[model samples]
Target: MLNYWIGMAAICAFAMAGVLAAGRRGMDIIALLFMGVITAVGGGTLRDLLLGVPVFWMIDFNYVWVASAASLAAFALARHLRDETVWAAILYLDAFGIALFGVQSIDKALAHGFAAPVAIVMATITGIGGGLIRDVLAQRENLLSSREIYATTIITGGMLYTFLLAQGGASHGASLCGVAFTFAFRGLAIHFGWQMPKWLTLRH
Candidate 1:
């Protein structure tokens, strides 16, 4: 299914990012690969449980293999590509993966007869859940803790996808738009250092 492939691609992208990020901390290759697999499967596993479907990886072993292979590849190549600039590459890839997963989650939720609002929320969760897990496990600050407009971008894209579906657009078409909008918003945010308005920032 389209959703499956989208999820798989996102998994690979995030896994690679996780490997690269962990490598920066001087993690061993095996540990880096383990983190990568976790990053890849964490979100979808959560999504499936929340949606009351069979955990995807349990049914399809190929997803596991793909994530594992991606992680290993990233680790093997880490030394060659390791640099301060790798952070930017990770960010961009993470954004793209998030976008894809967000749209797919929204579409999947809708197909399961969830209400639009709930679908949008689930989409946002799917987009960021894995990365949050990765950050926590890696002992890095969670992206959600920042004032950066990460989840906001996912929500915006989900809303757009939901709206288009309500307006009679095909599921695939709406998902495409959702992925595009999310990638564009996050990419712009990174390039321009965008953040939530100061008025909306919570003081510690």
Candidate 2:
């Protein structure tokens, strides 16, 4: 139950980021709402479908309600917010939501009998899937870029989390550590403009 609530809160946070992003572009409430729902449930819906499980929002309508409410609320209250504010929200909220959703999705996959590597992959997809969809639909820069190192951080943390979870004791604690690792890694990247080394970059 605690994890479920955490997941929903994370979803709402990312949804608000999406709404704020759309709102900045002069999108009306309806469009913002649409983007919010896509950002919130898009990842999890993909995860569940691939895992052959029931879709999450369809199972519990609260997810949709939370997303819609958050979108509307953010739209109403973001009038005074500047462009920098939305980017700030995107940086922090996206990192936090990625951590929460990644860990939760890993747990779900592990519970469903997936192997550690598979669970890690599942969580990686869940963590970044929505961002991928949103960036595409909004015609924004691709987030899964070698230069961004954004999705790379998620993948690294997912693998670390899966490794720790497989070590036997206190999986919950391990999960939190994983989230912290991802958040800190991303924060550092943002603060430093770190990216893959020159040697690792795709040559022109």
Candidate 3:
């Protein structure tokens, strides 16, 4: 139940962030809606498909409507904001959405009897798959292609969540800690322009 609501919240954040990204490209409202819906559901869709489960939005239909509504609302409000503000909001919203989706996906996988490694991988897909698609559609540089500590934070948090659960920590406490650490880590990276260590990145 809590996980369900957390998924919905992630959908809302991702949808709005998608709309802003598409709108920045001067896309039409229809295009904006398409991007929003895709970004909101893309990650979970991939995770479910890989997990051999029914796609969540298909099961709940409410997810689609919520993403659509949030996208349109964001589109309407974004027109009044500056580009700098829009980008900042997108980063923060994306960070928040990633934090929730990362832990939620891990929890889902664990519940499905997957091992820690598989659950961590699924969590990564759920945390960034949408943003990856959105960036491609928006013609923006994908975060994974950069040296930023983006996906690293998601993976780190997923590992922590799995470790805590394995150690018999309370699920609720583990989830909160995972989400908090992911969000704060990503938030700090965004604020401080932190980059991955040179050895951890690639060079042409």
Which candidate gets the maximum TM-score versus the true structure? 3
Please report the candidate that would top lDDT against the real structure: 3
Q: What is the C-alpha lDDT profile of model 3 across 1-204, one tens digit per residue? A: 876776677688788877876666557888888889988998889999999998988999999999999888888878654377666766787788799889888988888998999999998998778878988988888878878798899999998988999899999999999999999999999999999989866668
lDDT of 2 by residue, 1-204 (tens): 986787677777878877765555566788788888888888888899999999888989999999889878778777644467666755676787788788888888989998878787888788777767877787776566647777777788988888786686588789888899998898788778888788887788
lDDT of 1 by residue, 96-169 (tens): 88898788777778789999898888887777777788888888877788888999999999899899989999
User: What's each prediction's TM-score?
Assistant: 0.87, 0.87, 0.89
lDDT of each: 0.82, 0.79, 0.85
Give lDDT for model 3.
Answer: 0.85
Q: Give the RMSD in angstroms, all C-alphas superposed, for model 3.
A: 2.1
- Estimate candidate 2's alpha-carbon lDDT, on a 0 to 1 scale: 0.79
Worst 10 residues of 2 by lDDT: 80-89
Q: What is the lDDT of residue 48 in candidate 2?
A: 94
Model 3 residue runs over 4 Å out of place are 1-6, 24-26, 83-90
